[model samples]
Target: MRGLSVTETCFAIPGDIDSPTGGYGYDRRLLTMLPSFGVNVRHLELPGTYPAPSQGDLAATVDTLNSAPPNSTLLIDGLAYGAMPSSVIEKINRRIIALVHHPLALETGLSERRRAELEASERAALALADKVVVTSPATQRILEADYGVAKDRVTVALPGTDPALRATGTGTPLQLLCVGTVTPRKAYDVLIEALLPLKHLDWRVNIAGALDRDRETVAALNAQIAAAKLEDRVSLPGVVVPATLDRFYESTDLFVMPSRFEGYGMALAEAMARGLPIICSTGGAAAETVPDGAALKVPPGDVAALTKALESALTDKRLRVRLADASWEHGRSLPTWNETARRVAAAILDIPT
Candidate 1:
């Protein structure tokens, strides 16, 4: 796959690229790592805005596809496909494949109109693709149920954590880490509310991720924290370097993500790899990723439920031990990036050479 021309269409790469918006962080890593499995990848950056790929942009994309070499395999990441035009997707080369993290329409906190548009775009892309790779069984179910894609067209290739994230050494003041963009979908506010209930516990919550998309939601969460007098117990450290994040994971006692929805919960997997106990909402693919008994699970947006789970993880020594053991065992089963790339390559090649 390293030398094969693997064209990727994605919403954005890193900020260093032509894309105006920064990425979800995984795209850049995948772009660099996929080549190790023999994929000679070319990234095509799409616009940041929703209802993406205007008429002119669609025409340009079609022209590019039409001119590409015969048998060139186009890899369309699901995020970019959801924003693109149906007509544009229809013109995609027959050798194209799709890697679906999740359906954009199911993402939390989108306008109904936008959701409809995204769903339509996804339907078109699914129809055009020769194969589709999903990250979880839950997403595969959605693809079949909602998009009406044939079961044979879809394959599950779970995302893997970076090998660099592992337990380093113990530190004082148990740190509870949550990493993801600050947004309504992430349910940072719900975490804050849960934290308020556990103020008596001697622990700190540090959330590090991009914050531009949810300034208002973040501000409201700050106000809630202040009102609850949890200023000293919680910190929004914003985005941190990989080294810094690994350090946090090493020292952190627990990882919590109370997101209303998640496609694959990559951060949770990273935490598990680091041997950190987890507390996550059983929404979307989270339930599948965070196996039963491995992590405390709560209903999405249920403040009381999250609060209780947080309290248990913070105070119960036996529960923590159980969680740690389960998490470590589960983490060990995760596939490596090379494995993921190989699976993707096999899907692309489809038939014996």
Candidate 2:
């Protein structure tokens, strides 16, 4: 093996570069910022069907890793790394850093056999890495407690929030926004159930995310909305472009994310960054992301609590303002993208800053 190169690192990511999700956003932001910190990041595009890779995909991944220059530092995105076998790990001679957005097994809708397999595979994969980087402290704790990863081996690099215009809600009918992919993990069903009883309230909701990810859930949700006669009050606009999403944030009065789990609640942070008040589930990293008293939180999958919180936020104008104010203050306190990149670079380069 050759001696290590201190100024360059390779990042391996699966799926499309344009995927509009938080984990993808994190990788994109980091790749954009790492070069400024004097580390040349080479992005290695892995096959899309990770965590369920075909034999061909696995062979391609093995070829990619085996072909990397010896002693080079490789940062593998968890989606690809978590499913990799130890035989593959043994073939790579370079230092490896695993970037875990969240564990694979925590994803919703997995069968017991699949979950156990993922848990075991991920544990083995993480064990093979030289360092592990998690996006939030909540995720870090989960690894240490549940996955048997040592606390010292893990580093937390919280996702960054860009500065944006604060929302100026249309006063007549309050605008509530939910930004996340429509999947079982997001618990849009719970959100829909919560919104069902609030039809009399002068408010409208827009769920902006990739509905194509789960067609069955999307169809069921559509049916639920139709059956409840909420066609006018609720809308699912599918994947939103940046300009349109900004407009939604700019005009929104409140943001809600009823996710059952998150490695880091990037959408929630974005909303807070834009000074939108929040009502989110206390699932995974959410409670840690939003400051205390800044937003209301309920146990995940608790429809009644979510409904009650929504009701309070809608009915009381002062409560909304107070939450928004606190949220804005907390949002201002989050680290910027460059800072996050710098932290990761420091971890990658073994530099203290």
Candidate 3:
């Protein structure tokens, strides 16, 4: 496919675009950045009840999509796109471009019936897209292998990272930071268990992200912290503002993400952007997202392994410095938002009318 081109496309995203989650952040940035690269994008805000929309919301999704300019290409966010009825998907007049952050079936904690349903629905939805854009290579592979999408039909556009200042630790209690919504998939329970054994070490853990997304996970994590008597050492400062989050990145000594799966670890990339040493699990695209020297990789959901890595990172100065050095060097070369938009625009332009 050729590079960036001048083309009009419609991006239909479910829910509030201002949501503070990684997937929404990706979409927000693309909406802001794609236009500068010659891809004229018109935003369509679908009903927020997606991934499990009611019958009425499903009909609204179809109607909203069908209302787009007939000549414009329709780019649908996978959150809603994948769940659309195949019959309704075929009714839209515009050429379809599917942007999949990750397959919905890969999400943690789904029942067998729901998982099977999502798998079947997504497989059907993706087939109608003129082109598919995935946030990571791992996701691209998953679609091709499991969803039966052809290799040539998909494009891998890694998330873009903004430049950040290097972090300088607050040495008295080395600052540990984890960024992600408090969801079951994020595996905060595993993180809480892992950090339990390391309380004696000089570290204060701050989990920064929205807590309201999953009330059960939040309650469970709080219970774990209370039971472990880590209430003083660990804190969940939900949805830190941009200024405070920047301060967190600036002062953090180490970054950790123990997600059960990641389409692409945007938080990890943000950590690396700030030259912070990382400890993350090898789930989905997480392992490949951070280079070996840049992080202490552990198997996902392995509380013991995560605990060991945490202890080592906390106790050893040399390891943190070495990893940070690798991270700093790599961060300088990460793709910019423009590049991300360019790749997507190329995919959009590649679609045959």
lDDT: worst 10-residue window of model 3:
1-10
The alpha-carbon deviation from the true structure for residue 54 of candidate 1, after best TM-score superposition, in angstroms, is 4.4
Best candidate according to lDDT: 3
Clashes of each: 5, 0, 0
- Model 2, total clashes: 0
* Native-to-model Cα distance after best TM-score fit, residue 130 in candidate 3, in Å: 0.9
Model 3, position 184, has a per-residue lDDT of 91
lDDT of 1 by residue, 58-165 (tens): 566566555555446777666666566656766654466777877888878778997897898788778877788887889899899999899888777777665644
lDDT of 3: 0.90
For model 3 the local lDDT of residue 12 reads 98
Measured over all alpha carbons after superposition, the RMSD of each candidate to the real structure, in angstroms, is 3.9, 1.4, 2.7
C-alpha lDDT values of all predictions: 0.74, 0.89, 0.90
- Distance from true position, residue 88, model 2, in Å? 1.7
> What does candidate 2 score in Cα RMSD to the true structure?
1.4
